[model samples]
Each structure stands twice: as C-alpha cells, then as structure tokens.
Target: MIEMTKRIRDLEVSEHLRTLTHERFGTRGRFTLLERASGIGASKWKNFYYKKQEATTEMIAFWIEKYPEDESFLMTGKIPPRKDGYPFGTIPPHVRQTETISDRLNWVIVEWTSPRGAALFEYLEERSKHQIAAEEWKKTVLGEQAPTAAMVEIVCKARPYFAAWITCGSEIDSYDQVDPTCTRSIKTWRSNLLKQLMSAPSEDPEK
Candidate 1:
C-alpha cells in the first residue's frame, strides 16, 4: 500500500510572482489558502510550486495571504482580477476564430482511422496576449500533446486540461476535460510530466 504523508512542503516565494498572485486572489493567504480555495490538491498544486530563481504568481498570492502581515496588506489594498479577466472573460485577439476556452474545457474525443499514420492530438488550448502592447491572443499548448492513440488514452486517464486536436490530417477533434477532481488515471504521469515550472494562467481558453 502507498503510504501518504502530511508533510506538506512549505510553498516557495519570489518577487515577480508575489506581485502577480497578490493581484490574482486579492488576498495574502498564498497557496495554503489558495489550494483550499481552488480545490486543487497537492498533486496538481506542484504545477505552481518550486523554482530556484522565480516564484509562480499563484504561489506568491498564496504566500502573501499566509504571511503574518496579511491583514495589513489586505486592509491597505485590493488585488484585482487580471486585466484579461479570470472566470469571466475571453482571451484577447484570436487565430482559431471558431474556438473558445469554454469549448476547450469540456468532454471530447476523436477517432483516427489509421492508428499508425495519424497524429492523435491532445492539448490545452489557451488564448493569451500581453496586456501592455499585444492586441491579439494566440493558441498555446498546456501540457504535452499526446502523440498516439494509446498516449491519448493515457492522457485522458490523467485528466489533464487537454483535448484531442487531430485524429488525422483530415480531422482535428478538440475539447476540455471538465471537473479535474480525479487524478487516478494520470497521477503518476502528472508528477513525471509537470516539473513544477512557472505558469501565469493568464491565457483564456475561451477566446
């Protein structure tokens, strides 16, 4: 049996993300509270954790709220939702005019006739552009694109924020996997695949 431990690693911190996270949650609780608020568990939390040089914006927001001086910061100012608008907006500009974040984050499946010849694709399609100068949004990969049908199945099992992009050159099927509560199928892969890198979550899938 696998032995689970309660030794939650204290989340990391950095200045750049610190400013961003504080701006995201409008709070000082950091990941400790952000995790609870987001309902994302430790396994999924790693995506926002760890870094030698820079802290993730999500982690920074979590840290500020968790710090002792949290109330002081809270009392002084309110952090606003990103200018792009989380939970209520669309990514600015666009390439795939017909696609949307809402479209990406739903249940979808695609079939490839020639398993050997086709590229069974899966991805998290986000739309993003810099707030300052960029006026258009672009599609970007969330995790690795599943290379084969079997890989697609494994990826589906992982419950990643992904969608099948192409069954073959003839067809491209895409959709998001809703409700990311169950990581049973892809838990191990998530650990191996996601390297605790920095992410902005600024891009909107529904652009």
Candidate 2:
C-alpha cells in the first residue's frame, strides 16, 4: 500500500480534482460544481487548475476530502481506491517504501515541531541546523559507527525542531521536499536508515 501522502509528483492538482469530481458524481463537472463541492474559491482553484499557479496542501485537502476514497488515484493516477483503514497523513507501519520514507520523515518532524504557526524565520533557522547535523551524520556513519534503527527512531519520535524544515505542497518531487535550499537532508536521513536496513541479515518489508 502507498503512503497516504504519496502521489504522482507530476499530476496537477486541478486535473485530479476534475477527474475526481467526474467520478464521484457520475457526471462531468464544471467550475461551479467544483467550487460548491470543494468549498474552494473559483478564482483560486481556476488559477491552479489552469496552471497559472500550483495548488498548495491547503487547497488540495479540500478536494481530497470530497472523494476520500479516490485519494490513491488522485495521488498516482492508479485505479486502486485508497479506502485503506488508515487515515490521511499518518504513516502506516505495515507499508514500507524506500522512496516515500524520506518525505514521511519530513512530515513527521514538521508536524511534531511547530504543529501550527510556523513562521518563515523559524524554518530558516531550523533548516540550517538540520543540514549541518546531516553532514556530521554522514561522516560518522562512514566510519565504524553505522546508524542504528534506535538512533533513527529517537529523532523520528522526538521530533527535533532544529535541523530540518519543509513546507507542504504538491510541488513535492517524488514525495521529497522541495526546500528552495534543497531536499538533501531528507535524502541524508534516508541514507542513515538505508545503511542499517541494507546491512541487516534479513529485511523487514513492513518497515
């Protein structure tokens, strides 16, 4: 099963919404229908739908809520209904994705940190530390001390505020963060877990 937040990176939000509206109501929908159904402003959605602007996480949530069952389809253009029991945004322990793991980590960290009221300056500060810690982690792991699952779990659970920052949006490439600075930290953290996982005698598909 795919992570709830993972979706087709190139799929435009407006296009997905259009298809969802068509499927959910059993008819092709127009702007007025979309606006009323999703409770979104026409101008704003039109801007995104027409490619004048990209839809942010906030706008996409409205459309997703309308056809929650098709969330997987909306995310990947795949036919599988995302009617899995798990709720949106929470990582299911049973699904393992080497690819989506990084973004999931970012989502966990950001959500746990400034669950709300995150300011630009706050992000700027935390992002820098996250980068530096990652670089040092690389150096450490390259030696005799590879990362342990315990080490990764601590950071993932504790939700350290300093050292990483990424905003939510459809611009997420391959479920990786599009930090104007970079998605390197996500990759680096992924690397930390991958080293340990790959070295294990047996693999845990459920991880």
Candidate 3:
C-alpha cells in the first residue's frame, strides 16, 4: 500500500489534486472510491491514475469541486510537466542480446527508475527518446534494402494517441507520450517463417 497523505507526492500544485483523488479513492483496496467518485469521465480518470496522460484544467476543476475544502488547490497555477530526461541510457550489448521485451520494460519503468530515485515522486517527468536505427539494422541483419529514414521514422513514431487495442499492458508511458521503439525486423522474421512453413511438405503418409 502506498501510504498516501492528505498531500500526495510529486504532483504539482495544479496536478496536486490528482494525488488526492488517488488517496481518497485507492485504486485497488476494498471500499475504494475510484469508480464511485462522480465528476470526471472514466477515460480521463483512468488516464490520470495509470500515467497514461495528464489531466486537463477542466478535469482538475471537476475534481476540485468534489473536494470543496481543498478548493484552494486551484490557486496554484498549472506547472508545466517536468522536463528532466528520464528514459535514456546506452542499452548494454549484453542486455540487447539477453533481455526479453518484458526485461526491457522493467528496465525502463522499474529497475532503472527506482535506483535513480524517480519512480513514484517524479512519475510525471519527461522521458528520453528510444528511437532505434531501423534502416541500418535492416541492411546489416536482414540484408534487405534499407528503407528511407522518412518511412521508418513514420512507422517507428506511429503509436496511436490512444492504444488501438489492449496490449495486456506495457510500461511504455511515463506520461503516456513517450514514443515506443517499433518492432521492425521482427515482423520480417515472422513473414519469412510463415513462407517456409507453407512450402514444406506435410508429414502425413496416409494422404
């Protein structure tokens, strides 16, 4: 349990009420008020709790009205989101070789931040870019013609504004705007394997 106080940590004066919302309406425990709390739409509330997106001033006001005694929270002007670059480091060669996707996710969103002291407190801070070199990797690994930078960049940075489908879940979003590293050649491997399977003879002798 994250012992939340009357004032929650890391939230700005503008976003401060966000923490209170979480505290009063604990997301997991029994008797939690998240769904029961009335005002903001479920989408906005979910976005705020999971760090999927920042809440707007209008939404903030909605919550502020719910907690009238703390209405003074509105006086604090909206502080722009923190810009300290968080999600970057040269991925070690060994990590690239041995780490699974889950490992990479944990590295960025958990192990990396906890040691650096940014996990809970600076939850809303900015993240560093994770742009992979797709064209170069294609030329070297798949021996395929490299696509134009524009093409790969277009695909790589193309995560939808809202998730198109549930991915189970990922730690991709700190503030939910970080560009996810695209799966380029992995798609190629899948295509080639499918072709190989289609061309192979079936083992059934009875046919």
Please give, for residues 1-207, the per-residue lDDT of candidate 2 as tens digits. 364334445445456765654433322233444555456776775676566766667666865654354567677677663334323233322222112434334344333443222232234235545443433333222222443344345444454321233223222333222222234534544555467678788857998
Candidate with best lDDT? 2
TM agreement with the true structure for every prediction: 0.18, 0.30, 0.27
Rank order by TM-score, top first?
A: 2, 3, 1
Q: What does candidate 1's lDDT look like per residue over 84-179, in tens digits? A: 212212221122321443223322221111111011111211111122111111111111222333333443454344433222111222223221
Lowest lDDT sum, 10 consecutive residues, model 1, at 111-120
lDDT of each: 0.31, 0.43, 0.38
RMSD of 2: 17.5
lDDT for 66 (candidate 2): 40
Point out where model 1 deviates above 4 Å.
1-13, 28-31, 37-207
Question: In model 2, what are the clashing residue pairs, if there are any?
Answer: 8-75, 130-163
Clash pairs (backbone) in predicted model 3:
none
